[model samples]
Target: MGQLLVVRHGQASFGADDYDVLSPTGEEQARVLGAALADLAPDLVVHGSLVRQRRTAELLAAAAGWDVRLREDPRWNELEDLAQFAAVSGSPDGLDRDGFQQWYDAAMARWTGGEHDHDYSEPFVGFRDRANAALADVADEGTVVAVSSGGPIAAIASVLLAGDATTYGRLLPGIVNAGITRVISGRRGLTLLSFNEHQHLPPELRTYR
Candidate 1:
């Protein structure tokens, strides 16, 4: 069985004007994860095209001293329709962390419900299928490491585990910053080895945002 190491990109600028970039703590988390996984000697390093995902992949490769060139595949990117979510959730003038989470959860549910496919540029099924395709492409021989956002990672895990949208909803929120998820390709096809493993990170570095 071949192993696919899927990493959730580190924490992004949650409150900053630009939310695509990684926070200082996120950089540290990436470095820590890199050092933790140094023994595996991955053959290919791939990441979503988002700034945070790309930066995490670069930092992790540098920290781990892996010579492989980082690859970018947008299929691994997050569900990136913030305006649609805000509109669907009726976001207020200013949303704090808790408020945003409340709205985001509602928006996520509606998006995944398959009722509002017209509202989003990319529907849930489309996102999930693309994510699955990305996983299939990278699950080739040798150790493959991928840096992606929580949405797509959860999508991949949910489809493999239960083939349900509820599973994806359950898996998304708890994915830690720079968390590790392992999948194994075997006779039975893809299997979820682990999800959201963050034991390598210190207590202070653990974040979900």
Candidate 2:
């Protein structure tokens, strides 16, 4: 049997100019999770091409004292593009975080609703299929750790649990920063062992954005 431990990247620079970068809190979150998982000593460390995902993998591997080289897989990339997705749903100007979240939820619904596939360059189905492909490509008889974003993580989970991608957007909001989800491969194929495990984080470190 093989195991895939997927981690959502730590807290990112939400309101900052570059949202792809990790915040100070995000850095500490990675360090903490690294320390907690030091005993696991994963066979491989994989991450999305995004800066934040890459940085989290680096920090976690370093903190865990593992010499394993990190692997960059663009297939593990995020599906959400805040500005782009919001605009697709007709978001108004000057939306606060709360307001933007509201619009983003609506946007995700519209994007996945199947009626407006033409609106998005990459439809929701495409995102789900690619993410699932990426996961299948990485599965092996050893423990593999992948650092990615909430969108892809939720997408994979939705497919495994619900049998498709239509409901992934609904699972997005609950994915905390640096959250852990475990999937196992056995005779039955990929079985979701868990989703969104964050007990390693303290109350202050638990953030979803």
Best model per lDDT: 1
**lDDT of candidate 2 over 86-138, digit per residue (tens):** 55767556988788768876777778777888778788888888999989988
Q: lDDT for model 1, please.
A: 0.89
Q: Report model 1's TM-score to 2 decimal places.
A: 0.95
Q: Which residue window of length 10 is worst by lDDT in model 1?
A: 84-93
TM-score of each: 0.95, 0.94
| Deviation in Å, model 2, residue 45 alpha carbon | 0.6
Q: Give the TM-score of candidate 2.
A: 0.94
C-alpha RMSD by candidate, in order: 1.4, 1.5
lDDT at position 73, candidate 2: 95
Per-residue CA lDDT of model 1 for 1-209, tens digit only, reads: 77999999988998699999999988998999999988888888999899999999999988888888688999999987587777666864587778877777788889999998988889999999999999998776568999999999999999988769998888988999999999998888899999899999989999998
Q: Enumerate residue pairs that collide in model 2.
A: none
